[model samples]
Target: MSSDMNKDWPLYEVFIRSKNGLDHKHVGSLHAADATMAIENARDVYTRRMEGNSIWVVESKYITASDPSAQDPFFDPAEDKIYRHPTFYELPEELTHM
Candidate 1:
């Protein structure tokens, strides 16, 4: 498609989960008419090698993120909550992953 027509399409963020990965990771972005098209495009473009087992496509505009400039203040509150840290508790010896 022409550049002008591609610009008219909504931007989508693609995330893929590999066979062994527990969480999906952002791979890249693409322009698509809708969510379905985004998934197809993402699969063809990002996972042609068949490395990923799961795919997630989300329109870029719908995502909200914290401002990078405000990172300290935005995440500072969590530092004061010591109980949220994993070091607060001891895991069993059998808990391999933890």
Candidate 2:
């Protein structure tokens, strides 16, 4: 592999705003030399029609995510806790939207 191809750049996560959407959604990730290159690469790969007007590229190293394997310890304690659920609450007839 060439030096450029072999060079290990930081991974970047890309978000794109579709033509009709008001928010940018995470589309994919790629390894890039820097943020600028990542944006260009994301544009080429995600928005072929100039369909997206906004591009956000974040370093993968900075991304923090929840661990699914720890789900039981992380969230299950709240399952039997009925105070967290709203189903038992009664609403007034006049407050239909609420």
Candidate 3:
């Protein structure tokens, strides 16, 4: 297909959740005619090894994301909310993981 025709296909962002994973991780993007095709393509391309237990395909245009460049002001207010941090609990020195 021509580049322009390819661009007309909806862009899909793929996420895969492994059997051992608690959350889906964004694996990659692809172009597909529709959601069903997107999911099928994602499974064939990304989970051919049978590594993922679940898959998600979202059209790129529908996703809302925070701007990385605005991180300072966008997230600064949360920094002042000290209670949100888990620093109040004291762990025993013998516990290495904390």
Tens-place lDDT digits, model 1, residues 1-98: 79897788999999999976479999999999999999999989999998699999999999999899999989988988987877968778989976
Instruction: List the global CA lDDT of all models.
Output: 0.91, 0.85, 0.92
lDDT of 2: 0.85
Residues forming the 10-long window of minimal summed lDDT in candidate 1: 83-92
Ranking by TM-score: 1, 3, 2
The candidate, 2 or 3, that scores higher on lDDT is 3
**lDDT score, candidate 3, position 73:** 92
Q: Return the TM-score for each candidate structure.
A: 0.76, 0.70, 0.75
Whole-model lDDT, candidate 3? 0.92
Backbone clash total for model 3 is 0
How many clashes in each structure?
A: 0, 0, 0
Of the candidates shown, which would achieve the greatest lDDT relative to the real structure?
3
